[model samples]
Target: MSVGLVVVSHSAKIAEGIVELAGQMAPGVRIRAAGGTDDGGLGTSFDLVMSAVVDADDGDGVVVMCDLGSAILTAETALDFLDDELRARVRIADAPIVEGAVAAAVAAEVGGALAEVVDAAEASAAASAMTSDQNSPEEAVESTSSDRRGSDLSSTTLPPSSERPEEPIGANATLINPSGLHARPAAEFVRLASTFDARITVNGVDAKSLLRIMGMGLGIGSSVRVEATGTQAQEAVDALTTLLASGFGE
Candidate 1:
C-alpha cells in the first residue's frame, strides 16, 4: 500500500526541511506538509489537514504529527472533516515534529507500524536536550552510541524514483556513435546541461541517471536525446550538439 505522511508544523521552513530530510531517510515514501510561518497561528485547519491526509495515504492510512496546543486541537477539530470511513483510518499522533518525521521515514522504509514510529519520535524528543531530561547516565551514553552508529551508516540521499509522467517523444534518440557514450562525453553532456535552467533527465531502456547511464554499457554509437525544458531549453540542442558533435567519446 502506498502510504503518505503529512507533516504539520508552525513554520513552513521547518515543514519543508522535515519533508526534505524524510525524502533522504526514505526514498520512496510520500511526505506532504501543511503549515503557517507566523507565530500564534493554529496549525493546519480542518480542510487542509484532511486534504493532506487524504492526498498522502489515500485509503492506505496516514500518520499526522502536529506541533503545539492549538495545532493539536486544530487536528482534533479537523477529524470531524473526515467522513466516518476515512476518519476511522486517520490517526493524529502527538510528538516532537522533526523526530516524528524521521521516525515516520524509518518506519515507512522499514515497514514498521506507524504506532512504533510515533513512539520512537516521542521517545527521541523526551530525551532530547531541547525537551525533557529523563534519561539516566547509562541510558544517555547508550543512546549517544546508537546515534553515532546511525551516523556511520551511509546517509547519502538517493535520487527520487521516476515521478514524472512520460511525455510523447518527437524524435527517436538513437546511439549512433561508433565509440559509444563514455566518461568524457557524459561529462560534456552534463556540463552542457549545467548552463540552462531547463530540467534535463537522461533515461535509457536500462534506467535514467548518470550512474545508470554509464552502467548501461553503451559502448559506442549511442544516440541519446538531450531533452530540455524552460527558457534555455533550446540550449539543450546546442549543448547536446557540442557534446555529440564528436560522435560521442571516440
Candidate 2:
C-alpha cells in the first residue's frame, strides 16, 4: 500500500478543508482529518488524532501534519500511545499544515516511502522560507545538495571522485502545457525522477522534489534545463527532456 496522511488542526473545518484541497492533488491517497476536541470544541483531541492516524495507515505508513503547537502536542501524545509497530511507522511532520498536507499527500499518492513523504512535508516549509528570502533556485539546489551530502557522509563513506560522473548530462526543453508545471504535471515529473538512480535538477532545483519543481514557477513556453549526475545521468536527463517536450502528456 502507499503512504497515508493525517491532518490535525484545532478547527474541524480547517482540518477537513485541508483534506479536501490535498485530496484534489492526490485522489488515490488515503487522507484523514482530525480536528477539534472530543466534545466538538475548538481544541486538539488526542482521541481524534489517534483515530485519524489509525484510519490513515494502510500498512505502508502514516505522516501527521499539525496546524499549531497544541495540535502537534495532541498528535505526539497519540503517537506515544500507539502500539510499537504502528508508532515506529508514524512521523510528526514539522511543516505548515495546509502546504505540508498537500505536499505529503502528493508524495504518498506517488508511492513515496515514509521518509520521502516526511521530507516532502518539510520541503514545503523550506521552499516557503526560501521564497520569502528570495533565494535563487540555483542557491536552493546547492543548499539541498549540501544538506544531502552532509547526511550521506555522516552515515557512510562517499565514493571516490574518480568514480563519479565529472559533468552532468544536460538537455533543454520548453514548457508546452498551457498551465506549465502545475500540481499534476509536477507530480508526474517527480514520480519519474524518483524512479532513476541519478541525481537530477530542473532549472536548478531538485527534480525529484515536487515542491521544488513547482516552486520554479515555470509557465508555458518557459525554457527548462534538465541536468543529471550519477550512474544513470544520461538516461535520466534524456527521459526528463522527452517528458517535458511532450508537455507531460497534457
Candidate 3:
C-alpha cells in the first residue's frame, strides 16, 4: 500500500529543512508536518499531529517522526486514539523526527510505500547525518527518546485588527486557566480554529504569534473566549467548543 510520512519537531523550520533536503535524496515520496506553528506557535497536540499525519498519508500507510521525546510520546498517544483505519495506516519511524520526517516524507510524497520509504530515510539520515553546529547528526537530530523544552516560545499573539469590519461584533475572550494560555493548549486551540474560517485572536500579553498562543501561559481549566464573524462564525465556535470540551483532546 502507498504510505505517507509525518514529521514533528520543536521547530517547524528545522522540520521543513529536513524535508527539503530529503527531497533531494529521495524525490519519490510524500511528507507533511505536525508541530509548532508557521504563524509561530510551540507545542503541538496529538489531534493536530494526527490531523497532519492523516493529511500526509492520503491512504496506504504512514510513518510518523518526532523531535523531542515528549513529542514522540504525544505522537504515540495520539496514534493510539486514531480511528482503527488510520491507526492501521500509521507507524512510528525509529528515527529522528527532523531527519527522519524529511527523508520519509520525500519518499512517501513521491509515492513510495511507507516502510520502504522509512527504511530508506533511516539509511539516508544515517549516512548524511543531519548536524547542527556539531559535526554529528545526533546534535542536529534532537532527542525524541526524552522530553526537552527547547527554545520554542509556545504562546499566541493577536495584533489589533487593522482591518475594521463595517459591521463589528465586540467579542471578548477570557484566559480562564490558572496558569492562563500556554504551550499545549495554544497549539490545540490554533489547530481547532484553523479548521473553520473564524478569525481567532488569542488575547494575552503577547497574543499575536502562533507560538505565543502555544506558550501564552494560561492557567488550569481557563476559558479563552474567541470571537469571529463572517461565514465561519457559528461553525468555528461549535468546533472550538467541542475541542475545548474534550480538553482539546489532550
Candidate 4:
C-alpha cells in the first residue's frame, strides 16, 4: 500500500475540508481527517486522532499533519498509544495543515516512501517562502541555475529577454485550462518532470516541486516557458511543453 496521511485540527470542518481538497490530487492515497473532539466540539480528540491513524495506515506508513501546537500534542499523545512497530512507522510533520497535506498526498500518490512524504510536507513552507520574494506579477517567474531545487535564493531575476537567445533548450506554451497550473495540474506537471533525467525549470521555478510551480500562480492565458539541461534536456522540455499545450487534459 502507499503511504497514508492524517490531518489533525481543532475544527472538524477544517480537517474534512483539507482532506477533500487534497483528495482531488491523490485519489489513490488514503487521507483520514482527525478533527475536533469526539463530541464534535472545537477541541482536539486523542481518541479520534488515534483512530484515524490506525485507519489510515495499511502497512506502508502514515504521515500526520497538525493545524496547531495543541493539535500536535493530541497527535503525539495518540501516537504514544500505538504499538511500537506501528509508532515507528508514523511521523508527525511540523508543517502547515493545508499545503503540507496536499504536498504529502501528491508524493504518496506517486509512490514515494515514508520519509519522502514527510519531506514533501515540510518543504511546502520553504517553497512558498521562496515564491514570496516576487514583488509583482510583472516579474517573470524564473529560477536561476543556482536556485535550482531550492538550493539558493539569492537571485530571482532573469536576464532581459533581448539579451537571452532562443535555443532548442526550451519551449514556450500557453496555459489553456480554466484552472491553469493550480494544485492539481501543478502536481501532474511535477510528476511528469520528475521522470526526466534532467534538471528542469518551468518559468524559472523547479519543475519537479509541486508547491514551487503552484506558487507562481500561472493562470489561464499565461505563457509557460520550460527549460532544462542534462542528458534528457531536450526530451524533458518537449514533454513538459507538450503537456502544457494539451491543457493537462482538463
The per-prediction CA RMSD against the true structure, in angstroms, equals 17.8, 7.0, 17.9, 6.6
Q: Give the range of the ten consecutive residues with the poorest summed lDDT in model 4.
A: 137-146
Among all candidates shown, the one with the greatest lDDT: 4
Instruction: Put down candidate 1 lDDT per residue, 23-63, tens digits, no spaces.
Output: 66566677887776334354455566667777777456677
Q: Best candidate per TM-score, number?
A: 4
The TM-score that candidate 1 achieves is 0.48
How do these models rank on lDDT, best leading? 4, 2, 1, 3
**TM-score for model 4?**
0.85
Whole-model Cα lDDT of every candidate shown, in order? 0.60, 0.87, 0.58, 0.90
Query: Which portions of model 4 miss their true places by more than 4 Å?
Result: 136-168
Candidate 4 local lDDT, 1-250, one digit each (tens): 8999999999999999999999988888999999999999999999999999999998999999999999999899999999999999999998999999999999998889999999999999988877786654444445343347466435656678987755438889999999999978888888888888898998888898888888889999999989998889999988988889998888
Query: For every model shown, what is its TM-score relative to the native structure?
Result: 0.48, 0.78, 0.44, 0.85
| Candidate 2 accuracy as TM-score | 0.78
Candidate 3 Cα deviation (angstroms), residue 164: 80
TM-score, predicted candidate 3 vs. hidden true structure: 0.44
lDDT of 2 by residue, 137-249 (tens): 78889889999988887688767999865788899999999879877788778878888999999988888777777777899999999999988999899888888889876
Q: Model 3: per-residue lDDT, tens digit, 1-250?
A: 3576677776767667765654443444466667675455676666667787778766788787777887888889888888898888788777755445544544454455667666855654543432222334565456532234433325535345775463422244444444344444553455455555546554422222233354344576555655556677767766655555555433
